[model samples]
Target chain A: MQSFALYPFAPPGDVAALRADLRAWLAEHQPHDDVVKRANCWASFDPDFSRALGAAGYVGMTLPAIYGGGDRHPLERYVVIEELLAAGAPVGAHWIADRQTGPLILRYGSEEQRERYLPGIAKGELYACIGLSEPGAGSDLAAVRTSARETAEGWRINGQKIWTTGAHFSHIMLALVRTEGGSERNAGLSQLLIDLDTPGITIRPIIDMAGNHDFNEVFFDDALVPHGALVGTRGQGWKQVTAELGLERSGPERYLSSHALLIALIDAAGADPEPAIAGLIGKLTAEMWTLRQLSMSTAAKLAAGEDPMVEASVVKELGNAFEQDMPRRVRAIVDCAWDDDADLARLLRALLIASPSFSLRGGTREVIRGIIARGLGLR
Target chain B: MSDARDMLCDTARAVLRGADDIAPVEEVGFALLLVAEGQGGVGGDWGDANAVLHIAGMLAPDIPVADVILSGLGDVSMPHRAAATVSLMAGAMGQALALSIDHVNTRQQFGRPLGKFQAVQQSLAVMACEVAAVDAAAAAMAARLDASGFDADAAVFEIAAAKLRANRAVGVVTSIAHQVHGAIGFTEEYDLRRVTIPLMRWRGEHGNDARWAQALGRQVASFGGRGLWENLTARAG
Candidate 1:
């Protein structure tokens, strides 16, 4: 009789054009000469590359033009980030600031704060890191003991923050702390924009098994900031961080972490792959395609200003599982000898070491499932 | 969820309710839900029939609802049994998931429920992921079918992906569903085997994971990388 559709049949024309522009820019500017560095992709920290990207106006696209952003829709930014990620571009330097922090500030920052940080962030000069996970409280973010006491100057922050990515190099820390003390889990929390160089703050790198010093444990012992440091409202950190996480968990980066390895697997397999190997490739492609659609749909929701907490969690949970399983599955298909010089072998080796943290970084597998369970009314 | 689609779904559910046998379902017009108008039946599209397929799957009815519905679309050469097999496996997985959850909570080992064990929970968690992925894929396929008719060449990738992913999921879901049930699931008398055996048999029908995967792989290869991304993100307009 009659058919109907819920999802879009084709991407907006502007999005397709943006995709083409990004593809061309990446081809001309990306340093494809260094295989290992390129293999790092989003995790590779190259300030110069980020600066060039900013100059090209690919960063801070979703913010208002009044604050030096492109003032485009979130879907536009989604397109750019997806291209950068799939190509394994070195976007780590501005990844956090551009992806979520700038948007967070745009949404909640005071006029002065926006004028102070948005321009620099949009220009890709400023960098920021999330300050949610603590040594005592990671998945249980409400258990944050980092206290932000009222001071005549502004706020004095004291506590330890762990798993803070880009903390050492980043200029700002969106620290979540206990502003009003009580036994309540999520209340009494506030987000403060802490300058990393502020006094009494110490950042020591916690090198991962891959020997990458990307994340750190910061000791915020009475770190001081001026009155303009508070983001949104006091006692609203939990709410703000929850929104920020929706941005974090529902992007193309969630699933493209192991993309380099997939490409390498293809090259190693050659045109004539074994039937079993082809089958594995097919499985990976199908799952990735499905997750990609789900993620893009979530981006559409976010662009439409809908809070898709449940759908975002689905992306992270399923995406991370597929990413983490890539190395194992590729190993099954190819003869991974773990030689450092061979490209395929080296990529597989790096993925093997790095894959364990895929689930642990955004949210642990157990914690993500709990969120999904709650969403599904199973909990 | 239009008025017409909603009514058709209600009628289909009512007609197929408790239809452990296919004869009664055919006696009603439920079998012609996908038949086009003027074809001696009420006309409906793949999108409308998708709801019926999903509910039939969830209810785990033995009637060949998906098959009969597919046979009505005279132009397409799709095997009716293949469509039925997909829904059957999906429904069987749902039943297995529900049954295994109950088994884990009730069956005890070492004076505690099996679900209390960390290992068991982790396994169940993985199984849950598979089920979720399959569910999402099915819904996505339905939406895609609604937007672009199933006859369009563009729909092949999604159709292949959905069937491929669903077939792949059944293997993992059935394994874990059985693992958690232990010997009880292996026995013929237990209700779990009934669902598991059909799932095992359906896993090979209408082209299994490997078959659909090959089709998907050829399409991706022909399109190359850039076209591949276009195919993936084109749904966000």
Candidate 2:
């Protein structure tokens, strides 16, 4: 009775204007003609597109103005990202940085580091990647063996990070490394902003099942960085990383990756949505609604300046299913394929290719579930 | 917002927890459920009644107090039942019954926990689906009650729908829970014995699923042919 429409995170006042401005902006600037015409052909190394986003001030609309950001609410950022991703914008270049890294740096980065990184990130001129998952670490940060040896110059990093998205095209990596070998598994871990082109770092692409050039493995052999590169503090990387994850995992992107396809699918059905079709839609809509409320509650928890990791995981775990299931559900509903012109055919195709990454990229569904179970007082 | 309802629930929960060690309670459970104050376990109607049902669920995996309350009211009180309580007066979380069943440690024929069986899990999951329906219906109704006064017309449909959906779970989830527990599930000492009996008895008490459905359908046809989905919302609002 309240509203069937879920995930209306917009505050009542600015929402209408925001939606109008966004729709107009999106219509005027469709994805690069090539992207719209075909799907799965995205190249993550599109700097020109990134720069255009910077000029439009879409990259970092929520950070403070002094840092070259619009200093808007995260809710606005949430809606903007949903619209961009739904429209299939070539945001791969700035995706991680804007979504996770920028926020990480803003919230926990040292003052000088923020001054250095935030403006560049807001401009979309700089790129960033997370160097968290190690070769043997699995999802357990406690297992990380990446060591950062302190040098007079700063820190020398030596370890390999795997499953890092956009690692091949990124300019910098905010890496997590163990600075001390004490029994404290979480202690002694530190975050270093390692330059990808540094002397001892190598990046190699690891093609996924979809043959996407999105993810890569990185070898950090004594990579050098000044002391200022240490985000937060040494031995505090574990805390900083966990906090950053709360931002990374929660938000609209969790459920909206398939929204464009869902909308198009519904529009194709016309006025009387078939009962069988409506059942699927109703089920999907309900699941999405639950995840959105959980996510919004998480965001509300964050706005109150709490960790919200457990809540984030619950949302992400559920959210990923809703996102990943969309393409398969569309296919199952009526044997629809990537080439159907009923409406936004190319967009549908993009979802087919991109849906697999929905769970793996942000955090694997298994990992999210682990967080959720632990949150629910499980082992 | 009512203090009486809040206290009634607290008492119900306390009674349910302490009920585990007690012998199978078969002494006109409804009469005991509505003694007005201090006559037996609980002492109020709908709110107290269903709160006992929900808490009873945790202690005794198969208890159908939720359904019993709904149908008892539906059969005896008639119109008031339609206006007042939905099976969803029992506040719920997502897939609550399913998730709770996961913790039931009863062993099956295969020498494993019943939860270890896919068939049993699926059955329980259907119960979870019903619980989710209740979650949706209850959330909508609660939000309405909070924002404005409840409208009787809208309340009838929501209560009927919620009862129709969630009331079914008493038979479904509790039955499976008992099946998993075997003969012990029905015994006086086994803790959750009354669950199935109450759920089954309650289901057909207030005219069964058919009766409510017919009324709902007739009401739909009464309003100028096309279903008044929006008019229903106006009452809800």
Q: What is the CAPRI rating of model 1's predicted complex?
A: acceptable
Residue-by-residue lDDT tens digits, candidate 1, A1-379? 0001123323345766787789899999987645555555777888988989999999998788999998877777787888888788899999999988998998888999999999999998899999999988988888899998888988888899999999988999988889886636898999999889999999999999999999999998888888789999988888999899998888888888667776666565556666776677678888987777677777877777778776777788889888888888887768756775788788778887888888898788888766664453334
Candidate 2 CAPRI-style tier:
incorrect
What does the lDDT read for residue B5 in candidate 2? 67
Pairs in steric clash, model 1: A1-B43, A1-B44
Give all candidates' CA lDDT scores. Answer: 0.77, 0.60
Clashing pairs in 2: B63-B195
lDDT of 2 at A328: 78
Off by over 4 Å in 2: A1-13, A32-57, A83-90, A181-184, A336-356, B1-237
Q: How accurate is candidate 1 locally (lDDT)?
A: 0.77
Q: State candidate 2's TM-score.
A: 0.69
> Candidate 2 residues A57-171, lDDT tens each?
8888878999999788876676566556555566767877887888888877889988888888898888888888887886676789888888899888888999888888788
